[model samples]
Target: MSTTQSDRLRELLEPLVAAKDLDLEEIEVSRAGRRRMLRIVVDSEEGVELDACAEVSRAISEKLDESDAMGDEEYVLEVSSPGADRPLTEHRHYVRAVGRLVKLTLTDDAELIARILVVDEAGLDLEVPGVKGRKPTARRVEFADIAKARIEVEFNRKDQNEEDVTDEKEEEA
Candidate 1:
């Protein structure tokens, strides 16, 4: 899409998403065969749920139908939250990832995998896991030194199962 078109789309979408209490993370316009594909990525600190995405999609569709923003083109609109492994490119993204595992690459080309203990304007306090029965260590990384970062998906985190057990016990009380 041209710059003007992209800007116009953002202008049209920002308010709608904001009204729904979601941050518009990304907007991608692409060609899917002959039709255009409009992908909207929205997120929130509490996370975006499936129903929220559906609601946002419906609202976006209604607004577009009432406006000439899409220019009557045949386009598929998809609304979704960022994936589990999506790159952390913004401060807010890092803030949301606190207490989650992540893989970080430093500007000096060093790689580390750690759990985010805290996030501040300066950087992150990461809890680096230990190797071979050693204790986990804490490390501080400044934002300027982070070359790239991505959340590490943990399907079976030990703490997760423990939390579930605790929740079950609480419910039984």
Candidate 2:
């Protein structure tokens, strides 16, 4: 996608997303055979629902129709959440991944799979799952040491209820 086009779209549509309480994760304009395809990925701290996507899509589609951002081309609009496997990049992304398992590749060519315990500005407090029945251990992985980080998908997680990745808005009384 063109850099200017992406910037323009973000500039015009970000407020529309913010109005509905979502973070605009990414915007891509691509060719779909004879037409244009515009993909908008959005997310919120609580995660996005189908209705949220539909609402954002409608708002954005209407704005695009009124504006010339797409340059008079017929385009398809798709809005959705970042999938389960999306890479963790920004500080907000790591913060959102707290209490969730992630696969991290370090700058030293080592890989660690751990659940995020806490995320600060500099690094993450991770609970490295133990092997051979050993108890889990805490490990600190600095953001600088991370080469790549992606959320690990777990199906049939036995301890699913134990890790609540939601924001802690209420403290224990």
Winner by lDDT: 1
- Candidate 1 lDDT by residue in tens digits, 108-159: 9999999999999999999999999999999999999999999999987878
All-Cα superposition RMSD per candidate: 2.8, 5.1
lDDT, residue 11, candidate 2: 97
Clashing pairs in 1: none
Error of 1 at 168 (Å): 8.1
Tell how far residue 118 is off in model 1, in angstroms: 0.9
User: With candidate 2 superimposed using the best TM-score fit, by how many Å does residue 45's alpha carbon deviate from the native?
Assistant: 0.7
In model 1, the worst 10-residue window by lDDT is: 1-10
Q: Write the per-residue lDDT of candidate 2 for residues 48-155, one digit (tens) a residue.
A: 999989988999989998999999778889999999999998899999998889999999999999999999989999999999999999999899999999999988
Worst 10 residues of 2 by lDDT: 164-173
**Per-prediction TM-score, please?**
0.89, 0.88
| Model 1 error, position 27 (Å) | 0.2
What is the alpha-carbon lDDT for the whole of candidate 2? 0.92
Residue 96 alpha-carbon offset, candidate 2, angstroms: 1.1
For model 1 the local lDDT of residue 138 reads: 97
